[model samples]
Target: MTNSSGTITDKTGAPVTIADDPDNHRYTVTVDGVRAGHAAYADRTDDHGVAQRVFYHTEVDEAFGGRGLATILVKEALDDARAQGRKIVGVCPLVAAFLKKHPEYSEATSPVTKQILDWLKR
Candidate 1:
């Protein structure tokens, strides 16, 4: 999960911070320095030179569940990939389901293949 904190948005004046922890291969979301959620992914470049971000798991702490943190985690993770011109791959069911619900991100998602899933497991 992320360690370097940065503010992303502020709707009610309380900022939400998202940070990257590449050593852990995940992005973490924190509120007021308290960890709230995270989205984990594996990164690599495809043979075609496309940056691929394969998200495998995303979760919010039980105490923070239903506070829309999971949505924020996914959005931050996906948007980060998009900003890097990377295509997202959904190996985790949660990510796949999220994409289905929010097709706005469909254009940036990479097609899932056996190879992608196999690589994520490693």
Candidate 2:
């Protein structure tokens, strides 16, 4: 997988940075070098570096809504996960909804997402 580096600026000219925190194994997304979004997760492995259960929580700045910043964040988060060879467990409603709307991105999801979708089925 190709990692998108350099910078992706928001409408206000803020550079986007999606970084994974080694300690928490979560992601912190920044725009223009300032925090615009974040996602917390749990990464567990057994005798190997493989990820087990990755529960995620993501949120976007309200001011950045309607501009697809949330989608951008999700895309970056999923891209990072794919590069790291990890699956996702989206605990955030925003991410869950995004997944429901874009089945193409479901490749990043874990088995738990199906259970979550059971309740989210329309």
Q: Evaluated with lDDT, which candidate comes out highest? A: 1
Whole-model lDDT values for every prediction: 0.81, 0.64
Q: Candidate 1's residue-wise lDDT over 36-76, tens digit each?
A: 88888898898889889999888888976656667777877
C-alpha RMSD (angstroms) for model 2: 6.0
User: Across residues 28-62, which tens digit of lDDT does each residue of candidate 2 receive?
Assistant: 77766667667766665524455643545777778
Most TM-score-accurate candidate? 1
Off by over 4 Å in 1: 1-14
Off by over 4 Å in 2: 1-6, 45-50, 63-67, 113-122
Per-model TM-score versus the true fold: 0.83, 0.66
- lDDT for residue 50 in candidate 2, whole number 0-100: 52
By TM-score, how accurate is candidate 1? 0.83
